[model samples]
Target: MVEEKEKREDLPPVNFSMFILSLNTSALVHLGELPDPHSQQKKKDLALARQTIDILDMLKEKTRGNLTREEEKLLDTILYELRMIYLRVSGGK
Candidate 1:
């Protein structure tokens, strides 16, 4: 019944986790950690990556007390990993 409808592929799944995933992909791509799907080339752009991270940080800050435990964990984990990778790639910059 309702379960089948909920499982339909035509329905777009929208959620905070998906938002974080998109931002994470953008940050990774900018950091050259992920190959550019379009160009098939890995190009490091620390500045752009930093910008993406900052945006995530902003979301993290602004969404304080509003996100569920899972959302908070996902955001925190992503930020930590991305920051560490960014620092290493940018030579601790």
Candidate 2:
């Protein structure tokens, strides 16, 4: 476990921005916009994608007035892009 811990420690410090990006990556994977890390294949899981998007939305609502200007802009832009992609992928349903 020492080796694993050392590897993880080399990663960037976890912060709100990092957290948001992680969720963004997950949503992209679920939406088939990016390949799944484990499977190395792009697959559409609209339900999962929607859930991830909703989680980001909830974070935006909950963190209202708490995020820095840059952070807030990142969240808004990501949410909007994801929703648009979702609509197109889901046939606007």
Candidate 3:
């Protein structure tokens, strides 16, 4: 709908930071740190969480030295937080 499109247009512009944030959100949802948007229920899917985390890690490695300080810090913080949460949720496995 035109109204829906207009609402979406109000969203933040796509960028590296937004991309990373989106992945972070997905990881959180998989880790049960956040509810699944569609189901509105919390669920743990360790494998999927790990996969999403790995994707972020891969991006960090592939984009090293190219990201701005803020972006780098954001990625590092997100990765560290997610890893800690994952460990806690997975019994430190």
Candidate 4:
């Protein structure tokens, strides 16, 4: 059972921080901040960035009262920074 849980997603040791990092990476890519590894060019996609931010907000809402103090803090911080970046990138659109 433990092994199954660990290997369920083939993700290798998933954690809250990893989830946040994944979302951050997506948002950065959408904001044209992260260069594509293959093409080495930034791609700006505001719609996708908004979607990613919404997903993070959903996680924050759904996990309320279920996360550790540090997890909550980290989530909030990540969301805030991402929101700010999204706004800046989209010109408050």
Candidate 5:
């Protein structure tokens, strides 16, 4: 039983939003280029942007006054841009 408990603890946490946030943060850090850059870098940025939207979808359920006003607004802007990027990537009308 003790071994089982330890194993469970080693598993990823149940907070999907937090997981997504972590992924987004990592992607953003590695996403070199913005506002104008090489094609390859732009591709990376687009991928990160889509990932960020997915993160926002998860965050929508988790954020509830846990963030400051500025933080929330920042998240909102990220979500908006991500959605736009995702739409474009998906070939939106």
Candidate 6:
């Protein structure tokens, strides 16, 4: 029991970017079939999506015109999806 508890404690704390990356990875692995919309996991997904949008906004400001065409496209897609998720969570105005 002590060893199991220690192992659990040794795991890293999930952060915004890490959580987003995890969601992305899991979504890809599962072909985008995520948890129930009202589940706690969904809440984490929403939070991660918001954080991803904030990070991308900062990156856009910091690297404007410095990214390759493909990079720009990818960032645009990510930002758009994040915005959609944000609006859904915020009760679409």
TM-score to true structure, per model: 0.86, 0.95, 0.96, 0.81, 0.46, 0.49
Per-residue error at 62 for model 6, in Å?
Answer: 0.7
Residue 49 miss distance in model 2 (angstroms): 0.3
Please write out the lDDT profile of model 5 over residues 38-88, one tens digit for every residue.
333433455655565666766765885787676666667666765664565
lDDT of 6: 0.58
Return whichever of 4 and 5 wins on lDDT.
Answer: 4
Instruction: Please list the C-alpha lDDT of all candidates, in the order they appear.
Output: 0.95, 0.97, 0.99, 0.87, 0.58, 0.58
Q: For residues 1-93, could you state the per-residue lDDT of candidate 6 as single tens digits?
A: 999999989977975444445544443222223554444243234445555567667876787798777666766666676667567655673
Model 4 TM-score, all chains together: 0.81
Off by over 4 Å in 2: none
Q: For residues 1-93, write the lDDT of model 3, one tens digit per residue.
A: 999999999999999999999999999999999999999999999999999999999999999999999999999999999999999999999
Poorest 10 consecutive residues of model 2 by lDDT? 84-93
Please identify model 5 stretches exceeding 4 Å from their true place: 1-52
Instruction: State the lDDT of candidate 4 residue by residue for 1-92, as single tens digits.
Output: 98987778787567987887788888888889898667889999899888998998999999999999988898899889988988888899
What digit string (tens of lDDT, one per residue) describes model 1 on residues 1-93? 888876886656878999899999999999999999999999999999999999999999999999999999999999999999999999998
User: Measured by C-alpha RMSD in angstroms, how accurate is candidate 2?
Assistant: 0.8
Name the runs in model 1 displaced over 4 angstroms: 1-12
The residue pairs that clash in candidate 2, if any, are none
Candidate 1 residue-wise lDDT at 64 = 99
Give the Å shift of residue 43 in candidate 3: 0.4
Task: For model 1, state the Cα shift of residue 59 in Å.
Answer: 0.2
Top-lDDT candidate index: 3
